[model samples]
Target chain A: MDALVIGTIIKVVLVLLIVSALAGFGTYIERKVLAFMQRRLGPTHVGPFGLLQIAADGIKLFTKEDIIPQHANKFIFSLAPVITAATAFIALSAVPLFPTFVIPESLPLIGGAIVPSVIADVNIGILFVLGMMAAGLYGPLLAGMAQANKWGILGSARTAVQFLSYEVVTGLSVLAPIMLVGSLSLIDFNSAQAGGIGSWIIWQQPVAFVLFLIAGFAETNRTPFDLLEHEAEIISGYVTEYSGLRWGMFFIGEYSNMFTVSILAAVIFCGGYGDLGFIPGSLALLLKVVFFFFLMLWVRASWPHIRPDQLMWLCWKVLMPLAVVNIVITGIVVMI
Target chain B: MFEQIAFYLFSFLTIGLFLVTVFSNNILYAMTSLAAGMVLIAGFFFLNGADFLGVVQIIVYVGAVMALYAFGMMFFNVTKVVKEKNTSNLLVLFLGVSIALLMVIMFLSPIVPEAIFASVPPEPNATNPEAVGMVLFSKYLVPFEVSAVMLLIAMIGGIILAGKKMDQSLTKIEDEIISEKDVK
Candidate 1:
C-alpha cells in the first residue's frame, strides 16, 4: 500500500511537470512555425534559435504585475484562472502518457510498484477527460463575467455557445469509435487498433474522425473557432481584464487542452501508443502527438476565425447531423 | 478512511455552496455557487467509485446545463431583474427553515435508518456504466422508454412554443368577424 501511494504521487508529479513543460514548448513551436510562414523571425535571440525563450517568457509572466479591475468581482476573477489550470492538469491524470511499467525490485521505498500508463486509468477514461475539459469552460465564462467589461461578457457568451454546441458534436462523433472499441478507456482504444495502421478506427469512421477533429478544434478554442478571444473584435475577449500570471494561466489551460484533444484524437482515431511496424509504442505515440499538435498550429496559421453565427451554424446544421448519421451507420455496420 | 475523508469534504462543500446558492441576494453569486455545488456533487460521485456517473454529472450538469443557465442569466439585463422585493422576510425565513429541516429529515431517513450505514449494499466489481446499461435496457426498459418519450414530447413542445404562427391560429368566430368586417 505504501509503495502504491508513493509511486502514484511520483507519477502525478512527473505528469504535471512534463505536460506543462511541453505546453510551454508548444508555444515556441507555434511562434517559430508562424514566423516561418509569415517570413519573420520569431523569438530567436533568447537562446539557440530561441529554444530557451519559453523559459524567459515564464520568468516574465511570473514577475509581471497582477492587475484587477476596480469594479470586478475580486474573488471569482482570481479563482477563475486557477480553475482553468487546475482542471486542465486534472484531465491529464486520466490520459495514458505511455505504456505501464513495473519498477525494478531493487528500488527502495517503492520497489516493484507497477505504475499504470495513466495516473488514474478509470473505467471511463475518455468521459472523465471530456468532463474535465468541458468543465474548463467555466474558467473563461466566470472570468469574463467577473471582469465586468462589455468585451468580457461577449467573450463569455461566445465561449458558452461555442463550447456547448461543439460538445454535442464531439460526443456524438466519438460514439461511433467507442462503439467499435466496445470500451470507454483510451487504453482499450489503443489496443483495439494494435493491428497496425489498417486497424485504426479512422479508416472505418473517417466522417466521425473529421467531425471529432473539427469539434475538438472548437472545444479547445483553436483558430477558425477562436471567436472567444479574437483580438480584432472582442479585445482579447474574456481575458481582457486579466494580466500577468492570471492571463498566463488561461493560456496554459488552452495549450494544455489543445494537447489533451490531440492525445484524444491520436489515441481514439489514429493509432495511440500502439506499435507501428519496427517503431516502438511510446515513439509512435509521441509522433502522433507531434503531428496533431502541428496540425493545430498549421490550421491556426492557414484558417481564419469563423464568425460566431457561422460557428453555431456549422456546429448544429453541418457537424451535428453528420455526426449523427455517422453514428447510425456505424451502429448498423457493427450490428452486422 | 480515505473515502470517508473525501466524502466529508465534498459533501461539506456541496452543502455549503447550496446554502450560499439559496441565501445569497446577488443573482450572479447564487448561480456561481450553484455551479460549484453541482461540480462538488460530481466529486462525490467520483469518491463513490461511480466513475462514469461522475464524469456524466460534470459534463451534463456543470458543463452544459449550468453554462446554459449562465448564458441565460447574462442575456437578461441585470437592472431589470434586480428590483428589490418587499415581502415579509421574517415569515418567509421561518417557513423556509422549517421546510429545509423537513427536507433534511426526509432525505436522511431511508439511508441512515441504523446506527451504521450497511444500507447501500455493494454490487459486484463489474463496469458500472455497462451494468447500468444492461439492466436499464432489459429490466427497466419500459420506464426508460417512457422517460425518453417524455423528453421528446417536451422538446417538441418547446419548438412549437418558439414558433411565430400562434397568433394566426385564431378560432372560427374571430375569422368570421374579420371576414364580415372586410365585406362591410
Candidate 2:
C-alpha cells in the first residue's frame, strides 16, 4: 500500500515536470518560428540561444501585479487557468513516453524493474485523452463568460465552436487507428508498430494520419485555425482580461497542448519511440519527438489563419468525411 | 480494497457532477459539468468490467457530443441568462427523480456469480488481437456497419445546419455588396 501510494505520487510529479518543460520549450520554438517566417529576430536577449526566454518570462509573469477587473467573477477567473493546466497535465498521464520507461522506482525499485511508460495505462487511454481535452476548454470558456467582456465572450464562442468541429474529426480519425490496432492502450498501439519502417501505421493509413494531423492542429488552436485570437476582431479572445501569472498559465497550457498533440501524432503515426530497429530505444523516442516538434513548428510558420467559417467547413465537410472513409478502409484491411 | 475505495469515490464524483449538470444555470457551465460527469462515468466503467465501453463513452459522449453541444450554445449566442432554471417544471423534476430511482432498482438487482468475480481471468495470449479482429468482422459486422451509417448521418446533419446558416449570412452580405456596387 505504501509503495503504491509513493509510486503514484512520483508519477504525478514526473508528469508535471515533463509537461512544464515541454510547454516552456514549445513557447520558445513557436516564437523562433514566427520570427523566422516574418524576417525578424525573436527573443534573443534573454539567455544563450534565448533558451532562458521562457524562464525569464515565467519570472516576470509571477512577479507582475495580478489585477482583476472589478466586474469579473474573481472565483471563476482564478479557477479557469487551474482547470486548463490541470486538464492538460492529466491528459499526459496516459501517454507513454517510452514503451518501457515507467516511473522510476514506482514499483518498489527492485532489480529487473518493470518499465511502465505511462501513469495509468488505462484500457481506454485514447478516450481519457479526448475527455481531458474536452474538459480543457472550460478554462477559456469560463474565463470568457466570467470576465463579463464582449471580446472575451466572442473569443470564447469562437473557441467553443472551433474545438467542437475539430474534435469530431479528431475522434473519428483516432477510430481508424484504434480499429486497425484493436486496442486502445497507448502501449498496445506503440508495440503493434514493431516491424520495420513499413510496419508503421502511418504508411498503412496515410489519409487517417493526415486527418489526425490537421485535426490536431485545429484542436490545439494553432495557426490556420486560430481565429479565436484574431487580433483584428476579438483582440486576444478569452484571455483578454487576464494578466500576470493567470494569463501565463493559459499560454503555458496552449504550449503544453501543442506538445501533447505533437507527441500524440508521433505515437499514432510515427511508430512512437520505435527505433525502426536501427537507433537505440530512448534515443529513438527522443528523435521522434524532436521530429514531430519540428513538423509542428514548420506548419506554424507556413500556414495563415483560416477564417472561422472556413475552418468549420473544412473540419465538418472535408476532414470528417475523409476520417470516416479511413475508418472503413482500415476496418476492411485489418479484417483481411 | 484500495480499488474499491477509489471506485466509490469516483462514482460519487460522477453522480455529483451529473447533478451539477442538471442544476447549473449557465449553459456553458452545464456542459462543462456534463463533461466532468462523463469522465467520472468513464472511471466507473473502468471499475466495472467494460473497458472498451468506458473509453468509447469518454471519447464519443464527453469528447465529441458534449463539445458539439457547447459549441452550439456558443454559436446560438446562449448566455447564462438563457439557461436560467424554469420554475414551471416541479412535476417534471418529480417525474425525473422517480424514473431515475426506477432505473437504479431495475439495473442493480442482478448479481454476478461469486465464482466468476473471485478469479482474475488469465491474461490472454497476445495473439488475441487477431481473435478480436476475427470476431468483429464475422459476428459484429452488422452493428459495426450500422454505427458507421449512424456517424455518417450525424456528420451530414451537422454540415447541413452549419453550412445552410453560413450561406444565408453570406448571401445577405453579398446582396448588400451588390446594392452598393449598383449605386456607385
Candidate 3:
C-alpha cells in the first residue's frame, strides 16, 4: 500500500480506538467525579478504583438484547444509533488532539513517515467539526421520530431546538477566536497561542471563551442544558424508546461529543496542543482537555437542568446577543 | 485514483438520495434523506478540494437549515406531513431539481475523462482556508456583504413571523385561563 494510504489508515484506526475508549472512560470519570462531589465511593468493586468499569459497562451494553418497537420504522430505528456513533467519530477527524510527529526512516514497513495529529487536516477544520456535531442532532431527532412514541418525539423536538439554538452561540463565540487566529484550522488556532500561559486566546477573548464553554455544554447536551434528555420532565427524552446497546450508542456519542467540545474549547480559547514550559505539546493538550472534561462533570453534578422555555430564552435573548456583540467587537479589534 | 472513486461514489449516493428524499412516503424519512443528500453534496465539494466551501455547505445547510426543517416537522402530525406524491407541484420540483442537478454534474465532471485525466486537480486551496477568506473579502467582498445584509433581513422577517405566532398562542392561553376562572 502507498505510504499516504497507510498513514491515513493508521490515523483513522487510532482515532476510532482511542476516542471510543475515551468515551467509555468518560462515563467512568463522570461517575467518579459526581461520586466524589456527593461524598460516595463510586464503583469500587468493578476494578482498581473502578478503572475497568468502562470495560464492564461496554460488555454489558454489547451483550444486551436489541429490541425494536413493532410500529417503528425498522430500517431507520436501527440506523439511528449508528448515525450518532458514526458522526461523533467523524467529527474527531478534524480535531487536533496532539501535535504532529514524523517517524524515523529506520521503521521497516513505513519509513520516514510523517503522521499529522489530525486524521484529516482540512482547512476549515473547526467548521467541519461543528458541522458534524450539529449533524449529530439528527441521530436523536430521527430516533425519537421513528420510535412511534410521544416521549421520543418530544425528546427529538427538544433535541432540535437545543442543538439549533446553541449552535448559533457556538459559531458566533468561536468566530472571535477564528478572527484573531485568522484561520479556521484547529492546528492554526493551536499555533497562534504558542506563547505560554499568558498567550492563550482565553486571556484576550475572555467573553468568547465563557460563552463558548456555556454553549458547548448545550451543544453536547450536558447538564443544566440537557433538556433533550432531562429525566424528570421528558422521561429520558429521545432515548425513551431506546434500549440496550442502541441506547448505549447515544451515550457514547454524547460522551464523544463532550470530548470534542472540550478539545475545541481547549484549542480555540485555551492554549491548545502547544507545549507549556517543560510539558510536551501532546501532554499539555491532553491536560487541557481533561480539565475541561472534569468541568463538565462538575457542572453536571451541581447544576439543575433548565426548563425548555428558559433554555430557548437563554439562547436567543441572552447568549446569541452576547455572541453577536463579541463578534462585532472582535471584528473591530482585528481591523484596528 | 482514490479521489475519482470517491467522487463517483458520492455523486451516485447524492443522486440516489435525492430520489429517496422526494419519493419516500414517510415525511420523517424523506426529510432525513434530504439532510443526508445535502451532506453528500458537501462530499462532492470536499472531493473537488473546496474544503472551505464543503464545510460551509454542511454548516449552513445540513446543520442549521435542515435542523430548522426538522424542528418544523416536529410541530406537525407525521402522517399529515407526508403529502401524496401525485401532486403536480411535487412532480415539477422533482423533475426540475433533478435535471438541474444532472446538468450541473455533467458540466462539472471531467470532459473527455481520458484526455483530461487528473488535469490540475480541482482545488489547490483545499489546505488554505485563509486563501478562501482572502478571496471572499477581496474579490467577492461586496456580494458577501450583500448576502450578510440579506440574511439580516431574513432574520428580521423570521422574528416578525414568530412574534405574531407567539401572540396568537398567548391569547389562546389567556382564553383558557379565563374560562377556568369562570368555572371556578
Candidate 4:
C-alpha cells in the first residue's frame, strides 16, 4: 500500500515534468517555425540557438504581475487555469509514451512493472483520456464567462461550440481504431501495432486517421480551426482577461494539449515509437515526436483559420459520416 | 474487497456531485458538477464489472454530451436568468424520503437473512472485448440498433437546430445586400 502510494506520486511527478518540458519546447518550436515561415530569426536572444528561451519566458511569466479584473468571479477565475492545466496533465497519465515502458504493476508504489509503459494502464484508458479532455473545456468556458468582458464571452462561446462539435468526430474516429484493436487500453492498442511501418493502423484505416487528425487539431484549438481566438475579431478570446502566470498556465495548457494530440496521432497511426530498422526505437520515437510537433507548426504556419460555420460543416458534414463509414468498414473487415 | 470499497467511494462521490449539480445556481457550475458525477457513475460501472460500458459511459456522456451542455450554456444568453427554487412540497419531500428508506429496508431485509458478507469475486477474463462484442451484438442487438438509430436522429436534429440559425442570419445578410443594391 505504501509503495503503491509512493509510485503513484512518482508517476504523477514524472508525467508533470515531462509534459511541462514538452509544452515549453513546443512553444519554442512554434516560434521558430513561424519565424522561418516569415523569413526571420525567431529567438536568438536567450540561450544557444534560443533553446533556453522557454525558460526565460517561464521566469518572466512567473515574476510578472498577476492581475484580476474588478468585476470577475474571483473564485472561478482562479480555478479556471488550474482546471485547464491540471486536466491536460492528467490526460497524459493514460497515454502510453513508449510501447514497453509502462509501469507494470497495478499497485501504485512499484514504479517499474514488466507490463506496458504508462502511468496507470487502466482498463479504460481511452475513456479516461476522453473524460479528461471533456473536463478540459471548463477552464476556458469558465474563464471567459467570469471575465465580464464581451470578447471573452464570445471567445469562450466559440471555443465551447467548436470543441463540442469536433468531439463527436473525435469520438467516432477513435471508435474504428478501438474496434479494430478490440481494446480500450491505449497500451494494448499500441502493442497491437507493434510491427514496423507496414503494421501501422493508418494503412488500414486511412480515413479514420485523417478524421482523427483533423478533429485533434480542432480539439487543441490550433490554427485552421482556431475560431476561438481569431485575433482579427476577438483579441486573445477566452484568455483576454488573464495576465502573468495565470495567462501562462492557459498558454502552457494549449501547448501541452497540442503535444498530447501529436503524441496520440503518433501512437494511434504512426506506429508509436516504432523503428523500421533504420534507427533505434527510442530515437525513432523521438523522431516521430519531433516530426509531429513540426507538422503541427507547419499546419499553423500554412493554413488560415476557418470560419465558425465552415468548422462546424467540416465536422458534421465531412468528418462525421466518414468516421461512421470507417467504423462499419473496420467491423466488416474484422468479421471477414 | 477492494472493488466494494471502490464502488462505495464512487457512489458517494457521484451522489455528492449530483447534489451539487442540483443546488448550484450557476449553469456552468452545475454542468461541471454533472460532468464530475457522470465520470463517477462510469467508475461505478467499472466496479460493476462492465469495463466496456464504463468506458463508453465516460466517453459518450462526460465527453460528448456534457460538452454540448456546457457549450450550449456558454452560447445562450442566460446572464439575466434567475435561479429556480427547490419548490417541492414538504409533504412530497417527506414522502420521497420515507419511500426511499422503505425500499432500502425491504431490499436489505431479505439479504440480511442470508448473512451474505463475502466479497463478490471478479469475473475472470472480463476485460476481453470478444465477450463484450458477442453479448452486445447477439443478445442486445435490438436495443443496440435502436440506440444507433436514435443517435442518428439526434445528430440530424442537432445539425438542423444549429444550422438553421446560421442559415437565417445568412439569408438576412443577403436580403440586406439586395435592398442596398436596389437603393443604389
Candidate 5:
C-alpha cells in the first residue's frame, strides 16, 4: 500500500513534467508542420531543425512581463490560467497512458513497486475524464469574463456555447462504445480490443468514431472549430488581455487537451496500446498518438474555420442526432 | 485514516465556500464559490465510494448547470456590489435555526436506520455503478422513471419558453434594418 502511494506520486510528477514538456514541444511541431504546409522553413534560427525553439519559447514566456489588465478582475484573471492548466493535468489522472510494469526486486529504494498505467484506477474512468474535461470550460469562461475586454467577453461566450454543446455530442458518441464494451474503464476498453486490429471498436462504431473525432476537435478548440480564439474573428479572443506565463498556461492546457483527446481516441476506438505483429503495444500506442496529433495539424493546415452559427448548427442539427441514432443502433444490437 | 482527513478537509472547505456564496457582494464571486462548493460536495460522494454519483455531480452541476449560470451572470455588471435587502435579524435567525435543525435530523435519520441498511446489503462483488444500477432499475424503478419524466417535461417547457419569441425578435430587428435602409 505504501509503495502504491509512492508509485502514484512518482507517476503524477512524471506525467506533469513529461506532458508539460510535450505540450511545449507540440507548439514547435505545430509551427514546423504549418510552415511546411505553407512551403516555408520554420524556426531554423534557434538550433538544428529548430529543436531548441521550444526552450527559447519557454525562456521567452518565463522572462516576459506578466501583465494584468487595469480594468480586469485581478483575482479571477490570475486564477483562470491556473484552472486551465490544473484541470487539464487532473483530467489526465484517470487516463491509462502506457502499460503497467513492476520495478526489479533487486533495485535499492523503490524496489518491487508495481506501477499501474493510470494514476487513479477509478472504476468509472471514462466519466471521470470527461467530467474533468467538462469542468475545464470554466478556465476559459472565467478567463474571458475576468479580463474585461470585449474580445475576451466574446471569447468566453463562445467558449461556453461551444464547450457545452460539444460536450453532449462527445458523451453521446462515446455512449455507443461504452455500450459495446459494457465498461467505463479505459483499461477494460483496451483489454476488450486486445484481440488485435480486427476487434477495434472503430470498425463496429464508425459513425461514433467520426462524431467523437469532430466533437473532440471542438472540445479541444482545434482549428476549424477553434472559434474561441479565431484570429480573424476575434483578436486573440480570451487571451487578448493575457500576457507572459498566464498566456503560456492556456497554450499548455490546449496542447495537453489535444494530447488527451488523441490518446482517448487511440485507446477507445483504435486498438489501444495493443501489439501489432512485431510492433510492441507501447510503440503502437505512440505511433497512434503521433498519427492523431499529425491529423490535427494536417486538418488545421488544410481546412478553413467554420462560422460559429454553422458550428452550432452542425453540432445540434447534424452530429448530435447522428450520435443518438448510433447509440440506439448499438444498444439494440447489444440487446440482441 | 486518509478518508477521515479528506472528509474533514472537504467539509470545512465546502462550508467556507458556501458561506462565500451566500455573503459575497460580487455576483461572480458568489456563483464561482457556489460552483466550487458543488464540486467539493461531489468529493463527499467520492469519499462515500459512490464514484458514479460523484462524477455525475461534477459533470451535471459544475460542468453544465453552473456554466449556464455563469454565462447569464456574465451579462450582469460584475463591478457593482449587489446590495442585500434589509431583513429582520430575528426572522433570519429563526429560519437559519430551523433549516439547521432540519438538516441535522435528516443526517441522523439515515444512521438510525441500521436495520433498513442491513436488510438491503449491497452485493459485495458488484462495482458501485453496477450496484446502483441494480437498485435503481429494480426497487426504485418507478421513482426513477417518474423523475426522468419530470425532467423531460421541464426540458420541453424550457425550450418552449425560450423559443417562443426568438424568431419574432430576430425578424423584428431585420424589419428595422430594412426600414432604415429604405430611409437611407
Candidate 6:
C-alpha cells in the first residue's frame, strides 16, 4: 500500500481510538468537576479518585440491554446514533489534532510515513468540518422523530430549531476569520497567527471569537443551549427511548463534538498548534484544548440553561444579526 | 484507479438512494434516502476536484434543505404507508419522460458548439473557492445580487404570511379563555 494511504489509515484509527476514549473519560471528568462545584465526592467508591469509573460505566453500558420501542421506526432508530457518532468522527478528519510527525524509517512496514496532523486536509477544511457537524444534527432529529414518543418529537423539533438557527451564526461568525485569513483551511488559520500571541485573530476579531464560542456551545448541545435534551423540560429529549450501546453512541458523539469545538476554537482564535513563547506547538495546542474543555465544564456548573423560545430569540434576534455585523466590519477592515 | 473506483461506487450509491427516495412508501424512509442521496451528490463534486462546491453542497442541501424537509416530514406519521392516488398514469409517464429528456438535452448542450460554455476558465494556482469567487464577483455580480434580492423578498413574504397572528400569544389566549369562563 502507498505511504499516504497507510498514514491516513493510521491517523483515522488513532483518532477513533483516542477521541472515543477521551469522550468516555470526559463523562468522568464532568462528574468530578460538577461534584466538586456542588461540594461532594463523585464516584470515589469505583476506583482511585474514581479514575476507573469510565471503565465501570463502559462495562455497564456494553452489558445493558438494547431496547427498541415497539412503535418506533426500527431502521431509523438504529441508524440515528450511528449517524451521530460517524459525523462527529468525520468532522475530526479535517481537524489538525497536533503537529505532524514522521515515523522512523527502520520501524516496520508502515515506517517512514509522515502522518499529517489532519487526516483529509482538504482545501476547505473549516467548511468541511462545519458541514459534517451540521449533518450530525440529523442523528438526534431522526432518532427523536422515529421514536413515536411525544417527548421525542418535541426534542427533535427543538433540535431542528436550535441547530438550524445556530448554524447561521456559526457560519457568519467564522466568516470574519476566514475573510481575514483569506483561506478556509484551519492549517492556514494556524499559520496566519504563527508570529506569536499578538498575531492571533482573536485580538482583531474578539466579537467573532465570542460569537463562535457561543454558537459552538449551542452546536455541541452544551449546557446553555442543550434545549434538545433538557431533562427538566423533556425527559432526556431525543435519547429518552435509547439505551445501552445506542445511547452510549450519542454520549460519545456529544463529547467528541465538544472536543471538536474546543480544538477548533483553539486553532482559530487561540493560535492552534502554534508555539507560544517557550511552549512547543503540540503542547500549546493541547493546553488550549484542555482550557476550552474545562471552560465548558465550568459554564455547565455555573450557568443555567435557557428556555427553547429564549434560545430561538437569542439565535435569530441577537446572535445572527451580531454575526452579520461582525462580518460587515471585518470586510470593511479587510478592504482598508 | 482510485478515482475511477470512487466515482463508480458513489454513482451506484447515489442512484440507489434516490431510487429509495422515489419508491419508498414510508415518509421517514423517503426523507432519509433523499438526504443520503444529497450527500452522495456532494461526493460527485469532491470527485470533480470542486472541494468548495462539495462542502457547500453538503452544508446547504444535506445540512439545511433536507433537514428542513425532515422537519416538515415530522408532522406526518412517518411509519404509516403513503398511498398515492394516481388518477392518470399516462400523464405521470409523459411528465417523467419529458423531464428526463429535457435533462438529457441540458447535459448534452455544453458538449455541443457555441452552447454558452465556461466564461472563465479556472486559474491554475487558485483554490476552487477563490476561482469561484473571482468569477462570481467579477463576471456574475449582477445576477448574484439580483438573486439575493429575490431571496430577501421571498423571505419577507414568508414572514408576513406565517406571522398573521403575531400579536396573540398562546399563554395570553389561554388566560383570556379562563377569564371569559369566569365572567360567564
> Highest lDDT, which number?
6
Off by over 4 Å in 1: A104-111, B67-98, B107-125, B161-184
Question: Which number leads on TM-score?
Answer: 6
lDDT of 5 at B78: 61
Q: Candidate 6 residues A232-289, lDDT tens each?
A: 9899999999999999999999999999999999999989998889999999999999
- Candidate 3 per-residue lDDT, tens place, B1-184, comes to 8898998899899889889987777776677778888888998888867788888888888665556566555566553345564558887899999999999988877766765564233345435565566677877799999999999999999999878745333433677787897899
- What are the lDDT figures for the candidates, one per model? 0.85, 0.76, 0.83, 0.78, 0.88, 0.90
lDDT of 3: 0.83
Misplaced by over 4 Å in model 2 are A2-5, A101-111, B22-31, B63-172, B175-184
Model 6 segments beyond 4 Å from truth? A104-113, B70-74, B103-119, B163-174, B177-184
User: Over the stretch A46-73, how does candidate 1's per-residue lDDT look in tens digits?
Assistant: 9899999999999999999999998887
Q: Which predicted model would earn the best DockQ?
A: 6
TM, chain A, every candidate: 0.97, 0.93, 0.97, 0.93, 0.98, 0.98
Clashing pairs in 4: A3-A109, A4-A108, A4-A109, A101-A117, A102-A116, A102-A117, A102-A118, A104-A113
Per-residue lDDT over B60-91 for candidate 6, one digit per residue giving the tens place of the 0 to 100 score:
88656546655565567776787877899899
Q: Is candidate 4 or candidate 6 better by DockQ?
A: 6
Candidate 2 fnat reads 0.27
lDDT of 4 by residue, A1-336 (tens): 566556667768877887787788878888998999989999998789999999899899999999998877677788889988988988888887764655556667555655346777777787777767767877888788777788888887787678768988988998898888877877777778888788999998899888888888888888888887788989988889899999988887888787778778888787776665878666776788788778878998988888887887788778888888888888988999
Give the TM-score of each candidate: 0.90, 0.82, 0.89, 0.85, 0.93, 0.94
**Interface DockQ of each model:** 0.36, 0.28, 0.48, 0.35, 0.52, 0.56
- Per-residue lDDT of model 2, residues B1-184, tens digit only: 8789988899788888788878766665566667677767777766765666666676666545445555554564434345344576888899899999999976775654442452334235533334445666777799989999998999789868856656454534778787897899
Docking class of 6: medium
* Model 6's DockQ score: 0.56
All candidates in order of DockQ, best leading: 6, 5, 3, 1, 4, 2
Point out the worst 10-residue segment of candidate 3 chain A by lDDT.
A109-118
lDDT-better candidate, 4 vs 5: 5
Q: In model 3, what are the clashing residue pairs, if there are any? A: none
